[model samples]
Target: MKTKRGKIPGFAIQEMMVVLAITAIVVGMAFSVLNLVQRQMGSIEDIYEVKLEANKLRQSLWIDFNRYSYVNFDERKGQLYFSNELEEKNYTIIEDMIFTEKDTFNVQLEHKAFYFKNHEKKIGEIDAIELKTSKESGHQQIFVFKDNAPATYINHKP
Candidate 1:
């Protein structure tokens, strides 16, 4: 084969270094973006978990509240009571009505406030009850109940 002299072609050391630097910058950016996405996804999952727990708690409250004729809360004892009638009953309301995977989620029914303020009376005839849960954050939610028709009239505070 006849050898022919030609100008050296392809990338120089400086060119290679520039390429390497560009590649490193791109990889670093990609890694940072990936990390951010993962963190956001994790936060979303936590929020979903909290919402699911709140829904379950709300459903349980609706079931118990409907079954019993009256709901009462004793602040001093931090206990909730449910009775079929004003006098007595076979089944009573239980304390700590809400449940969550996390032990810190606190659930309480304010029966005393409702009773004293006459909120139950506002419910009127007890046709049906609606439960709604709102997310406070990734770890918490506020559950609210609306009564369709309550039997008695009671006073309430703003």
Candidate 2:
């Protein structure tokens, strides 16, 4: 008696291995993209926090500066004092005097030892004041505030 033979045409072991390898590659690529997105989200959050803090500081400074007649930087006390007139106000205008007690933001006056004979512009008449803050040795931001306006120009140079 003659018996009929049939051939199976399904995927072999090698083909299954190849398909698994391709799937692994695709999954790895997907994970890599997910990681990149997460990192970017973290960076954006950090940037937003920094910007918010800067805005708050700038507003506080402008208000205090405008309310008082003069700003005196006391290096010994590590504080800034604003008074209606020198030796007139009994209270010293430090950070805690006007705003919240938290000391996250501190302002220090930089006085150039050499006098600029040509620089006769008064504080209000001056175009702008350059303020700088640093997060680290290499990371810093330079902000420019108009003398009479509340607008601020932020320059982030890292």
- Which candidate wins on lDDT? 1
Q: Could you list the CA RMSD of all candidates, in the order they appear?
A: 7.7, 10.6
lDDT for model 2 comes to: 0.46
In model 2, the runs with Cα more than 4 Å from the true position are 1-9, 83-103, 106-130, 135-158
Candidate 2, backbone clash total: 0
lDDT tens digits by residue: candidate 1, 1-158: 99999998798999999999999999999999999999999989977776766566656556656666655554344344555654422212234343322323333333322333323433222323333333342233433343422453442224
Q: Whose TM-score is greatest here?
A: 1
Per-candidate TM-score against the hidden true structure: 0.53, 0.50
lDDT at position 103, candidate 2: 40
Model 2 / residue 109 / CA error / Å: 9.8
Which lDDT tens digits does candidate 2 get at residues 34-146? 99999999988877776666566667656655665444443344334445544422222233222334445433322211111224322222222334444421133433222
